[model samples]
Target chain A: MSNALSVKNLNVSYLGNVALTNVSFQVDEGALVGIIGPNGAGKSTLIKAMMGLIPSETGKVEILGKPIRKTRKEIAYVPQRNDIDWDFPIHVIDAVMIGTYPHLGLFKRPKKQEREWAYQCLERVGMQDYGKRQIGELSGGQQQRVFLARALAQNADIFFLDEPFVGVDVSSENTIMQILKELQKEGKTTLVVHHDLSKANVYFDELILLNKELIAKGEVTDVLEVNTIQKAYGNPLAFMKNEIGVKQA
Target chain B: MNFIEAIIHYEFLQKALITSVMVGIICGVIGCFIILRGMALMGDAISHAVLPGVAISYMLGINFFFGAVITGVLTAIGIGFVSQNSRLKNDTAIGILFTFAFAAGIILITFMKSSTDLYHILFGNVLAVRPSDMWVTLVIGILVIAGVYFFYKELLVTSFDPTMASAYGLSTKLVHYLLMTMLTMVTVASLQTVGIVLVVAMLITPAATAYLLTDRLWVMIYLASGFGVVASVIGLYFSFMYNLSSGATIVLVSTLLFITVFLFSPRHGFIRKVIKSRKRASLAN
Candidate 1:
């Protein structure tokens, strides 16, 4: 089977300070991979670099054996919830409908069917009733659900979510994970930049452990060992271990 | 006769009225985007920065629009470059670049000793507008409004969430520059009616009023355009009857409209919120 995403020698920097260095990773089809690391360890930066949201100094990114740009319509990215100005004057439905905009060329508006499809995506995320509400009025979890609805509306082959679970309520978390699993079943590849190390083990199929460099990339069961977690986190895994132990219990 | 008869009788009055309405509509439409994007200061900066372009065009005996547009775009790029490349914020970049351009304009006007009246450019004389100026404004107004209509969705996404715009393969940079260019055009086009001193008001007040009244972008645009035209017409009428300054009167009218909306708009106005809170307090008692 062809690889869903392939990254080679990816390097990124900000103001002469290196963020990611010589990072290489690849994901096979229909895999749910989590990229986890310590704070400021370039987990977000790696997602941005792979999505071409930021310019990489030296790297190559290919999606399903083709350049990423040619398949833009086949990819969806949901940035962190805080990345948006929620108070912007947009209705929730209008925000979700923007997902369909990439498939349109200049001068083409979203048709009625596309609008209905956006409503359906919102339904999938249980946000159909709040479609008329302003984005600012929604809670953090609802805001996140709206973002997921937007990504779903894109109908993409590959999905990238950066810190999707941060600040989300428990029910919203379950809703998102359920939708992501459904996407995987549909043969879509999902890469998530996760922050919670405890949930990382249980949530992802594969893992890319990093601390400004790729430490391990394999099945979660193999990569979640104490030694590997210590290498990525730069400390003993006492906090993570306690949380994981509680979760397992 | 009455005001209606005077408008029908005087060709100059008709021209002034037509020019005011067109300028009002264009500025109001474009202003919605400017204020929504929090680029109100950028609007003020670009409007003032076009002074040097006008001065240079007068000295070169060329159409002022060409010089004004070029200078406006350069000012935008300069502000963008300074903000992006340095640690300075956007406000600092706008202040530095606009003042530099404005100073250059004042110096050029003094040095060249051009015959064009600087006072009229600084504080516009809508009554003195020539037919050619009216035509130029019309063409620019149509082009800009059409551009906004055609690229509405692209502009919406890019302005609301640029990161998503990029992830979905829209070039955020190109959209930004395109908006800057349109802003430059609208600034230049409105110069003849509102002048640089109050162009920012013409661009912001009516839109701000509409913003208070509506939750939808299209409705905001529609309401703002209507408010703009009404303000301009009323202002022109008052200027005609009272022998006052047209630009200043138009700005004053729009400001008055905004104040009304601020106090009384049903959705987001201060008075409405206050009233609702008072009712809730009484009900609790």
Candidate 2:
């Protein structure tokens, strides 16, 4: 299988303080990968740098064998929940329509086909009924689902989600994970920044453990070893409990 | 003479009326984006910072529009530079640069001994608006409106979620600077109607009122522009009838509209929310 994403020697600094240092990893095509880390591990920073949303000290990121600038249409990114202003006076469907902007470019408005496709994306995420509703009127889980619908509307090959599960309900979490798995089966690559270690093993096919640097990158079994977990988290006790839970399941 | 007859009979009044309405429309349209992007203070800053440019233009016998736009854009870039390079926040930078430009303008005007011109620029006398000033406002009004109409999507996406906008390879910085340029033009165009001191009110109040009345950006823009026109027309009438400061009267009318929406808007109003909760409580009882 070919690699859908390749990162080499990625470094990022926030206000002169080092956020990520010498980090590098590759994501195989159609693979469902989770980025696991402790607090302040630069998980979000790494993804931001890869997308070129922020200035990176040094790095190279290629999507589908092309630089990000050349292949932007094939990529979709969902930033953290708090990164958005929930009360920005936008309808649910209009927010989804924003996903089409990468393809629409400039001057041309979203036509009937684009609008129908946006509605279909909402239906896939079970938010079809909320098209006319204000974005801020929804619950946390519904908001996350709406955002996922927006990403789905992009119809991209590689998806980057930053903490999509944070503040989300169990049903919404399951819905999001199910959609992500479906995307993978369709030969798309997805990288998720996940906070819940208990579900990391079950949720992802591969794991990239990080702590200001790349600690491990391999199958879940290889990356979740005691030594590796300890290196990344400093204390494996909490992770060990989750590990036992995973084993029992 | 009554306001309408005066407008019909006197060309100066006609120019004042047209100029005031155009200012209303442009300020309303641009103000929606400004408030959405949380740049209302930037509106105030640019409006004040243009004073020095106006004074310089008067001294050089050139059009004040050129001078005002240059100083306004400079102040905007200066604020962005200071906040980006240092720990000082945006508001601090805005406060520092705007006041400096405004004080410099006052000194220049004093040196030129143009106290009456200073009064008109600061307080705005629409009755004294010249034909040239009227034409300039009309041209700027068309440009500002066309800019918003053509770039609505770009402005919407960037203002709503800049991170997402940038991730999609859209140049948020470019859009921001473009909006800033439009804002400077709008501020300069408004000088003949609202002047510098109350121009921010025209830029923010009508848009804020519209914000409370809609859930979509396009709707907000339309409603804001409508509210701006209503306020300008009515304020002009009151100013002419009562012999008051035209700029101050227009700003007050816009503020009154905002207060009315704040208290009574159907969906997002303070009073409506309170009434709904009270009804729910009564039903429980």
The reply for model 2, stretches above 4 Å from the true place, is A242-249, B279-285
lDDT of 1 at B89: 97
Instruction: Give each model a TM-score.
Output: 0.95, 0.97
Q: Residues A73-157, candidate 1, lDDT per residue (tens digit)?
A: 7888898988898867789999999988888777899989889999999999999999999898999899999999999988889
Query: Model 1 over residues B57-134: C-alpha lDDT tens digits?
Result: 988989888999999989999999999999999999999999999999999888766445777788788888889889
Residue pairs clashing, model 1 = none
| Local distance difference test, each candidate | 0.88, 0.90
Every candidate's CA RMSD = 2.2, 1.8
DockQ of each two-chain model: 0.75, 0.80
Output the number of the lDDT-best candidate: 2
